[model samples]
Target chain A: MSVKLKALTKSIWVFHLAASPCNNCDIEILDLLTPRFDIERFGMQLVGSVRHADAILVTGSMNRKARIRLKRVIEQAPKPCFVIALGNCACTGEMFAPSYNQMKPLDEVVPVDAYIAGCPPKPEAMIMGVVALIEATLAAAKK
Target chain B: MKGWGKMSDKATAKTTIIPIGPYHPLQEEPEFFKLHVQGERVVKLEIEIGYNHRGIERLAEDLTYDQVPFLVERICGICSCSHPFACVNAIEDVGGVEVPERAKYIRMFTGELERIHSHLLWLGLAGHFLGYNTVWMWAWKYREPVLDLFELMTGNRNHYAMFKPGGVRRDFYEEDFPRAARLLDDLLRPLIMFRDVALQDPVLQARTKGVGVLTREDCVELGALGPTARASNYCIDVRKDHPYAAYDKVDWDVVCTSNGDVFDKVVVRVLEMVESAKICKQCLEKLREVDDGIDCNLKEIPPGEGMGHHEAPRGEVFHYVRSDGTNRPVRYKVRAPSFMNVPTNNRACVGYTVSDATITLAAIDPCYCCTERTAVVDADSGKQIMTWKELLRLSRQKTERLLEKYNSRMDRIWT
Candidate 1:
């Protein structure tokens, strides 16, 4: 856990992977880069390519079609990359869980390190999720 | 390889095809665009969708009438209210239940505010596409206050969940009026400034003006809706043509422009925001005077078929529901604005330079999440010389060159 935090020594580049999302979480993710939330100021930024990402932020309910693409994209990320499940769909599949098209919730398809709750969590909640990710690793390293 | 091997048999083999999508930042959703470029100009465009499909219509059949509103609200987060607005309208139409007069005003108020926020979001993305990062930042900065208003009113920023079959869920409190009024009043001066800057700015004009022309005939032929059609002078707004909720009750002019170019799309939206603000102001002021209670609770919907559509920020969000005297709808169909609007991009992007194609594709503000579930078949993508960065750099460089040209041409352009 502490070794994964080595990437936290510098800014963390997150690649936004929107599977079969409603797009509320995607917009809320973008909201972080806006003036009010501005995650870049805290040394977190969204990158266009997965190869450059230190962590992959996964959103959506992991429908069958997207599940394939999500698995392929996650496999393409560099080693030691962390996967964070965003929104209720990604964390627990929420209401969309029963749909025939929906695959397993995100964690079932890919290893997930952190989870952010909310149908589409507020920008503040996402920011806190990231901070908690770092804090948890630090606390574990102290042990 | 097989797909392209077959495609290569045509003259298209001579043209370099660039595929954008599935996971491009420009799309933000999973959809694909295949641009056939002859040198610098796009000769043809092919679009593929359905990557985000969660089978909402199929799922709607399983949910009861009461639970369907929440399901539809997630169709597109930005249009969360618009979806439910149309959903309830259809359910109400089926039941032949009349919405409360006060609820009409409250629903209109939320829908109008969503319009303002959605437009600003598009404006910000439009700015980013043109490499006017400052405008992008500013447009989004102004949008935060609108999101705050959504949170204050509906208790959630994205999915308002304000609508049900008979009427609305939340009541407009008089105590909330002053703050909402102040927000609208505060929004005016900046919006006016934004309109002036967006319309009159030389750099923006050079980048967008006369680019991606979707002729009025083209718009009609393609069945484009909302600003895409309005910009082309097609002049069809559901709010004006078929008034529902409080649209007929209130007075606000539908904003339209004749040019049918990318600039006209910007003009229609920028001007439309001012009009939306006026509607919000009117709804709030009149809501204070209306004494009718909200929610005319219709316990059960009778067996019948009904259809309802709202003029969403993007275009018409239509819902068709059929009841069999059961709590659940026997059949449900959704026709989102983007489903109609996205095809216009195929017509609009053609004949434009590759640099201009991105903005044109985005000009319709296509919501692939909403447009998804229509159709999708995997295509074999070949190697391409262009990356998303190269296309962005091409657009930015064009603006830089135009900036340099205009700077030298103007007499008063002293910097």
Candidate 2:
């Protein structure tokens, strides 16, 4: 009932999908929540369930198994969901592209809204990406 | 195809089924296994994967070799340096490019830094899984220095893209050497503190002591390596055995343990972290003493196939690469550390209670999600399943939940 609620409109909830990541990105993503690079300060979170997120944070280059699970995850998310690709692997196949196992850039598989470049972008950069997405969303709302 | 017929022909062949993974209290990832138990122990097990398949391998074929390093490094952020190191090493070998001596030290430095951080991460996770939240919190708290060091070197905590084909992309200046030294020193003190606590903590000992027991014989038979295999008295460290990068010049001991259990593996990693720090210290000294040279000098790759193996945090990571003198490789194969550990999951889980099985499975540090993300073929028909609709649904659910959790729950009623 207060105007303070208006200030919270730009916050975005992110659901991180591993998508056959090497486990390094998965851990760092988790690390973002562990006080040092706390995302909650920016109103970001790694939601356990996909049914509650505004944007999807995807890691790893898509692989066969990751594609299946990621597809399921992406499908589960609501419409107008912002997708952020965390690393170069997810942005493009990277080194595993020539390998028989990996799938190409996550954009080829899912509709991505923003791209954060880094092997695994720092949690700070990751948080910035979220903020950028939220700003984009708020700007869109004004339009 | 071997099925239930492979079971022993005994009078009491009754097997009780216990479903594991797809979410366990202790596990962070999902993998389902149907364990057939006779009495109090497992007689057989049928593994069911496909929980986290994202088609990583299929995706690899489409990326360029230069571009592949970043992707492969993302395969496991904890061991980010290992994958790219293996990939680039193979590329350099096939391409016949000579990396400068200075870059070799930097590569070794990053590799060891990865090992230290990875081991600490595992220690924290293992503690969390064992209900030792104090250790979990403390270990991660101490891990900050290493991450800081990583940031100092690569400008990012994880995914340090410091390596290139000929040598490396990063070069350490004179001033950076002291900063790295100070960071390494800070990391060493906390590491020693955590090491003592991890070894002496009763809860950690009780939860991980006898759980996930992989005997020496089991380790050898299962072909386990790294700390997982070394915990069972397997003195195999690819760095020591194969001498990759600048490991031959670095003086450090390959930490080994006798009892292959969760506790033993924990000890091995803790000790390994110290050893890595020692190697890092040596690396720092070398970095200061080493004269100027190129980190990497890219060259054209020739047509040939070669194998490269490096000891990653989990175990030995092997890569096979073939180049046809092109910017992209003809073939690239990555044998992740988890690939070897996944097979041994059964060895640790069998004959143990369901709870023990869960802890044991986690102790092996199996990346089940990554392992299952691709290769989704029907068992009977071997038919491929398109994942678009399913993924979209999951994405929608995740988005909705995120909105609710963050208190942004579709504020149409806000005004």
Candidate 3:
């Protein structure tokens, strides 16, 4: 049972939080789940709830209304959970930065461990972002 | 009074509230649906959207004619071109700009390709929600080639940004047409299989058929548009009623079904893919027929107000632009299909089980980004007076009254 548990623990469970996204980033995130990208190969599985997540994937810019909800979701996740900002809207706010609806950049509200930058970052970029996050966490653990 | 998420009112008997989002797996955007459930049946559904309120219309008022298309394209990632299709139409209407013949075909081609992509995305998501993971995987696999086609032609998978005021941004190369045509051809086999498999699958029919029904009266009264309306046996297609671009020139029939159930909605969307593919083929043939270089021909604008509506994948995306012969539109009004279609859920979810309500809402293909664009204004004063709090209070009162009436009726039936 411990051997099976150890083997299972290697796979990461990710919770996706869509914070007032136009859904471009969210849809691209789904692309990683679909068979074409097949993120399961990298020991990644998308969990439904934040509590079950090892990592939280934050998509979309931080809008005023959703920012509160974003914080709540982040709080709900298990301790030492990594938050990865996915796409330009989440990473840099992009064209929607000037809007009154937006609260602030995503990194301001949540400590974004890594950023996969694109209008909607391609799935390849997303895989690399997760790997980089894993490496950084490993390096930090070693230190 | 805090926000739509808070359950402040106690006017009705308490029921199990299954709050789906601000963030949920069922939907990609941050819209909340509060369901009042009694056992398995859902008595009421209060939709609290506006989380994805990017303030695009207000932003459009500030942007120039050239920039508005780019801004509006981001309204919904899936319906990326739908907003711009309406935006450019409004601009051209104001300027009385005659788009080149080739541009019309290119617009239609891109628009149909977008329709195919958006519908496939919905199909894949619908599959995912139903716990039909295989369907989700396969539907999305078929969709990859469509994105590849988009990448091939417009250089980006989503947000093609092909639409400009006068015409398309880039010219269609003669070489890409055959390859693009071939890619679209690849989608047909899987689409046919999907339609057949969905129609034949008993489990799917049992889950979806006669579930979340919106009657014809309910559809018209609620002003449901697009597939939501079409599923209800009501035919009101913007492409047919108000033909724009090459839609009038091309020959295609509006796909409508008798039942307004989730199953019929699925059927309508699946059948419509065939029609979109057919239309794209004809548009491609015509594009090759017409001179390729003359994709966009520019003309100057005169002061005027113009309205444009496109039959987006969801429904009609109506854009109203009033230009005072200035570089920017003085007022830009966008009415996405979901703006009207979303309210139909008020009736659609009334009798269905709690489990089925999500699929019913998804059947409308509600784009929260598109629906959250509007703000209430005093018509006489031409100014805003009602605060967001006031609006919430008014809506909550309505919700409370609905809940009270429904629970009281439930008590009578149970007793």
Candidate 4:
């Protein structure tokens, strides 16, 4: 793996972008930071700004109002930014797929590097997804 | 959209219009708040919601009556049980379905367990807002067990999907009572410790006490429900007032405090967790007494309208269902407690500074997404002065200053 890409895996600052989610996945994301799960131990932190983010954690289905903002947020992030779709809604649009208000899944809107699937994925599953994403990035960088 | 245009009227030369949210880091749900600030104090506040509106009510019209419970459960992840419980009750009310006695106890048990977890989650966030990261960590640590209990009982952590029209989808077996009761007993120790810490800690008291004073009159006029109303001694709990599920059978007090401050709200919730734990323990014991049977036997819903309300962790979760003698509901309406409590911020936030305002707004235990970005625009020059990060930094700084002040005062008294 390239040194630059290896460095990226050490500490990934994620900016959470919610697009009208049911909040189950959103809360689970927050739960990861709490003492029990402590995703910070893996050097993952939730930053307040997209500009400071290395990875974007997207939750919920892309709704009409949030679609523009979601696109803008993704665009504003620096290049080499990884997008992780954090729930069933974000990954596939779930129940919101049929709704007129919802636009599309996260992959259709933006390239998703990793997908964590659960109605709201458990914190353990979320951490493993991030780990897998890091491994995938390392593999790609090596080639 | 309705209140966004009106914010311009309040903008004056000295006033800086600070827009908090639409997507801000402090909020958990997406909501927009326009704060008309004169100096550091918020003079007038305008709230614009519907950013999180998913048209769940409209979607419910298409789903069958049985399918609506699962749909309603997704409305708010924290209050998942409340919506489905209320929906089930409403359907039962319409169809005149008699739920088995044991099912009522199971419903109440799960509902109260949700309350315990929801309140703990709010407590953690409240601590985070106050710059007490330890409190946030500890509160969340304690909250995990409650969620674990939820996982054990319902098979899922947040969305149980257990509520049906006439009764619950799952039954709490008689054999499971002892183990469940033990877990609940373990939960009480940490809850009591947290309660004592909140009550005795001077820093928390200084930060919260007399900060967000929503009087009983303002509470009633604004139609505040749940702990927001109970904090002001308004005395309205759907469980106590309406007595749905097995709440009538259980003996528990509605935790209330006369002071309408943020501290009282914290006290009310912390104490309510204790009461909720008690209710859970009692329900588990009652499960042992009742004989096991079919949880629900609801086949069809008749043409009628029924209203059901459950005291969700936030406040009263009201569901109105109109069944047109068909499988699907003609019209279904859900009113989350945050719907009523968010508007009361208009009255509660007038005199407080932005820092205090943050805690005050949070004191209602708002169940929306986190606030992300805030921009301060100078009305006279029409220039943006402060960004979202600056505003959040300012709020945190104010909390630190208050904490220092309170700490020194305590030191002086002790020495």
Quantify all predictions' global Cα lDDT against the true fold: 0.85, 0.72, 0.83, 0.82
Q: TM-score of predicted model 2?
A: 0.78
Write model 2 residue lDDT over B151-241, tens digit each, in one string: 8887777778887777777687778878888888888788888777767877777788888789999888868878899999989988988
Alpha carbon deviation, residue B176, candidate 2 (Å): 1.0
Best by DockQ: 1
Candidate closer to the true structure by TM-score (higher is better), 1 or 4: 1
Which residue segments of model 3 deviate by more than 4 Å?
A: A1-10, B1-14, B292-299, B374-415
Best by lDDT: 1
Error of 1 at B207 (Å): 0.8
Q: For residues B148-195, write the lDDT of model 1, one tens digit per residue.
A: 998888899899889888888878788999999999888988798888
Cα deviation at B343, candidate 3, in Å, is: 1.1
Q: What DockQ does model 4 achieve?
A: 0.46
**Per-model TM-score of chain B:** 0.87, 0.83, 0.87, 0.85
Q: By TM-score, how accurate is candidate 4?
A: 0.89
Candidate 1: residue B10 lDDT (0-100): 54
Name the runs in model 2 displaced over 4 angstroms.
Answer: A1-15, A39-119, A129-143, B1-31, B35-45, B50-68, B95-98, B295-298, B368-376, B379-415
TM-score order, best first, reads 1, 4, 3, 2
lDDT tens digits by residue: candidate 4, A6-61: 77777999898878888888889999999889999878899888898999998887
Candidate 2's fnat? 0.44
Kindly indicate the candidate among 2 and 3 with the higher TM-score. 3
lDDT (Cα, tens digit) per residue for candidate 3, span A1-143: 23432332357898888887888988888888898999998778888788888888888877776787789889988876788898888998888889877768988887888889988788888888887776666655555
User: Which model, 1 or 4, shows the larger DockQ?
Assistant: 1
